[model samples]
Target: MGEKHRSRWVETLVLLVRNPMAVASSLVLLVLVIVGVFGDVLAPYGYNEQFVGDQLESPSGSHWFGTDDFGRDVFSRVLLGAEVSLRVGAVAVGISLVAGVLIGLLAGYYGRWIDDALMRFMDMLFAFPALLMAIAVLAILGRGETNAMVAIGIVYTPIFARVTRASVLTVREEVFIRASRASGAGDFRIIFRHVLPNAAPPIIVQTTISLAFAILSEAALSFIGLGTQPPDPSWGRMLSEGRGFIEQAWWMALFPGLAIFVTVLAFNVLGDALRDVLDPRQRSALSGKGAAR
Candidate 1:
């Protein structure tokens, strides 16, 4: 089983590297991770350090991005902001993934009333628009980065729940699952060891895709004054602050906006590539086409 899994993973990776867009996007995400991890070392100035007279400065050799309204180095702020955005997305998704997967496992495994109750609850959450649900969660939880993370996590929970439940439902009836049940395996073992692993491909792809949305959600919350707060740099807050000086220092908005755009696009492209690589039907189709060619 371990060898088969390793070989499959290697093949999937080879397929991913063969796709130019996936390779490019993977490099972009890798750079984001590097920037997030080593931002302090890479940054020339403090994220909050003020230059006093250099407010709204354009891009120059001194500041790759520029200075914001507070004369804080935009490049430094953006570098650190990558960490903040990534943390928020990861925590939010982690929250949703844990809760959703557990709920889905129980609902799928038990079925009947548990399934009805859980799915109905998920359906109610799904009824609301994602951003609106996040806003509603924030309204109750109040503001700040922690609250924003919680709100976004709550907003995305239903999506993960639905996906997990669907995947679990499909996997639970398989021959291996029936054999496991007949072999007297505990519910926990079966769910985690066998079922969850099989159900993971779509979940993994969904997670990559979800990070893009999570980043956007965090930015939206920050833009409206409900996230990150002042003195802490956030890409969204940067955009909000830069809007007024857009004409004078377009670099303020342009660079951060581009950061958001590029990051989101990279995640999406990578997710699509993952989906294509992970799907057996897609793989067979590609192999068939290659053979015909």
Candidate 2:
């Protein structure tokens, strides 16, 4: 089982790497992760340290990205902000993934009343636009990074639930699932052992896509003063601060905006590549063409 899983992953990796866009996106994402992890070490100056004399300095040999209105190093702040953005995405996604998967598995396996009840609840959440719902949640929960994370997770949960339930519904109809039930497997055993593994690919692709959204959501929240309070470096907050200085100091907003754009694009591209590589239809089509040739 382990060997088969490993081989499957290897095959997916091979297919993913074969796409130039995927390979490039993967490298960009890897660099972002490295920067996020070692940002403090990589940054030349402290994120919040003020250089009053050099305030609002344009990009030069000394300041790669320039200084902000507060004389803080924009480059350092952007580097540190990478850590915050990545953390928000990861934590929010982790919350949604676990809750969504469990709800989806139960709803798909049980069906009937259980499915109706759970899906209706998810539907209620879906009624609101994601950003609006996140904003409403943040409004009620007060303001902070933790609150933003929770709000983002809540906002995205329905998306994951819907995706997971769809995947589970198909997987539950598979022969192995029926066999597992016939062999006297318990509900937990059948759901975890048979249903989850088969349903995982789409869920993983959804997760990658969700991460991009999560990052965007966090940025939006922070831009509105609902996330990552002052003194903390956040891309959204930086953009908010830079709005006034756009005429004089474009670097203040440009660097952080570019960071957000690149990071989100990388995740989106990676997600699309994953879907192409992992979807059985794509694989079957490729195999059919190969055989015909």
lDDT of 1 by residue, 149-237 (tens): 99999888888888899999999999999999999999999999899998999899989999999999999999888988988989999
Q: Which lDDT values do the candidates have, in the order given?
A: 0.90, 0.92
Residue 36 of model 1 has an lDDT of 96
| Candidate 2, residue 285: how far the Cα is off, in Å | 3.7
Which residue pairs come into collision in candidate 2? none
* Per-residue alpha-carbon lDDT of candidate 2 for residues 54-81, written as tens digits (9 for 90 to 100): 9899998889999998899999999999
Q: Candidate 2 has what TM-score?
A: 0.96
Which residue pairs collide, candidate 1?
Answer: none
Q: For each candidate, what TM-score against the reference? A: 0.96, 0.96
Q: Candidate 2, which ten residues in sequence have the lowest lDDT sum?
A: 284-293
Residue 245, model 2: Cα distance from true site in angstroms: 0.5
Question: How many backbone clashes are present in model 2?
Answer: 0
Flag regions of model 2 displaced more than 4 Å. 1-4, 286-293
